[model samples]
Target chain A: MTIVSYIFLIIGAMFFLLGGLGVLRMPDTFNRIQAGTKATTLGAFSIVIGVIFGSVENHLDWIPKLIIIIVFIAISSPIGSSTIAKATYRSKNIPDNLVQDDFKKRGENQ
Target chain B: MKYLITFITLLVVYLFLAGFVIEEVILGSFVSAVLTILLANRLNFKVDWHFPLKLIKFIFVYIPVFIWKLILANIDVARRVLSFKIPLNPGIVKVKTNLKGDLGKLTLANSITLTPGTLSIDVEDDCIYVHTIDVKKSSKDQNQKEISGPFEKILGGIFE
Candidate 1:
């Protein structure tokens, strides 16, 4: 593997590990979702890019597929995280020390 | 015209991702574009021909700020989780919004949910139902004001 590929692999691994740590260490469901989405998206993209770089055969094919993967991840991760966070919030699992909420006002306005 | 553009964009996106050859891709794109246009027209969704340039720009600007907030919240949450006491004072709060459009409302709601420690549960006409992780620091009502302040400004800049 080339130096760049190795670098990408290392970066990907670090991001994946950070995501795991965030999931384990975050105090609340919302925080965990934030960490999981951001870190995992970066991690997965990095790994895919690394693979594209390291591959000797059909490099073009891999690159396009990687691009597709990145695009899908970017679009979908936030939606999934938002859904989970909403569910958790409705379920009343949030931490007790929160300072402000804008959603409730939205409810009142309706 | 707006529906046509949206349809074309969607079709192109679909074909590009699907990785079809040029001819097949064009055929698929045309079919999907026509379908999208028909559906959108039938649904009575008004297509705003004049683009919200300011709103698009604001979204880009707000992204970095949102990321910074996420990182800070992550650290705070991590610390709390590691502590033996696990300091938490969860509560639900309502926040008022000034965004005038559906897109603006959605942007604000999604942004709030993306932030660590806050979840946007529901969105009413001009209000939002947010569940917060820490409620001991302030009253639920006060929390609503503080929580909505930045988002209101950001979305206001974008939508209004």
Candidate 2:
């Protein structure tokens, strides 16, 4: 692999590590989701881009797949996070420091 | 005419992504688009193609800014995680959205959810229910309001 590709791979590995750390160390579910979603997306993207560069012969094919993967990640990650957050909130697993719950109020009103 | 346009757009997108032959892409897109249009019509859904062109510029500008904010939030969360004291006060707060349409609501929800330590729980009428992982005692209101900035700009660009 070229120097640039190695750099990208290293960066990607760092991001993935941070994401795992976030999941382990973050206090709450919401924070963990954020760490996992954002870091993994960028980390995976960087690694894939590196792979694309390393495989110059199949660059065209891999590049499109990478784009597709990025798009899919962008569209689905937030939705998945939102779903998990909502479930956690409803299940009362969130920490007690929260103030100003409009969702609960709306539920009460309804 | 709308159906034809939708069909063509879908076909082009399919061909571009799948790298299929023009003929196969055209056939597949036509079939899917026709089915989608019929289903949409039956569901009384309207497709608004008159998207504000001015908002396109805003979208392009907002993307980098949003990504920057995401990175900053990630760092903040990482720091909090590494700290000795677990300073967490998670709560759901409702912020009123100024966005006017379905697209605006979706954009706002997605943006909020993308940020670290926050999640968009629900959207009802003009308000978005967001859950924050860390809610400081004195600055709860300020934090909630600050969270709206990214969504406001991006949704405003897309909807307004």
Candidate 3:
């Protein structure tokens, strides 16, 4: 159990690192949101699961609290990313050389 | 009915967080009752004969699919970020959904954002504008089926 927990923790840390690197490397706001949100969401979930495993024997009650945390993250993270993406688009920080842009047409008409 | 639902949901959440202690459960029930009275009417949901079926499907089917897609999304992101060229042909394209319910549409948008290379930018009526990190240049356009993939069909069965 200890080994298993450690493995999950390590994996989570690696993903966190990747998310930071992605934020720095991506060209624009939307892409950075994509990398940052997805990677960190998974990373946090992994770390929580690790905590559950690590503490399960002595603290079974922690499981439900951890599950609640996971549920909250699953709900809130995407909403945050979506809001940022919308704000970025509305503020005209859109990237050049987009292959297709249907939003532009809709934005103009509306 | 709305009050009952809200009360029960809140109580359950409280109990889970409080570790089901005797005093905590009592306190939780009290708080939940007050909150339910105040907030019941604000939440919008429908309960019908299909409610149980939808709940089962959401738990058994939809969750697994979403998790699998999440893993794939991370791997895809990792590959792109790690690559030397960071190959990207990003774009925002519209995809249409037939779901009429607010919850259904919201779930669809969130699912798109968390899965694969797609992030939902905005939703307008029946359509969602998605930002894709790697747009297929061949088609020059995106369709609902390609962007949403398997989710729409399952979501339709559950939410609609």
What are the lDDT figures for the candidates, one per model?
0.68, 0.72, 0.89
Name the 10 consecutive residues with the lowest summed lDDT in model 1 chain A: A101-110
The better candidate by lDDT, 2 or 3, is: 3
Please tell me what DockQ candidate 1 reaches.
Answer: 0.31
Candidate 3 scores a chain A TM-score of 0.94
Give the residue spans of candidate 2 off by over 4 A.
A51-57, A97-100, B20-49, B52-55, B84-86, B139-141
Which one wins on lDDT?
A: 3
Best by DockQ: 3
Q: List, residue by residue over A10-106, the lDDT tens digit for candidate 3.
A: 9999999999999999887888999999999999999998998899879887899999999999999999989988988888767897878889899
Per-residue C-alpha lDDT of model 3 across residues B43-134, encoded as one tens digit per residue: 87765667778889999989999989989999999998999878888888888888899899999999999898999989898999999887
For model 2, residues B55-151, the per-residue Cα lDDT tens digits are 5654587677777767776676667756787677677777888889787688678878767667788788888888777665576568767778766
| Candidate 2 clash pair list | A97-B89, A98-B90, A98-B91
**Rank order by TM-score, top first?**
3, 2, 1
Report, for candidate 3, the interface RMSD.
Answer: 0.9
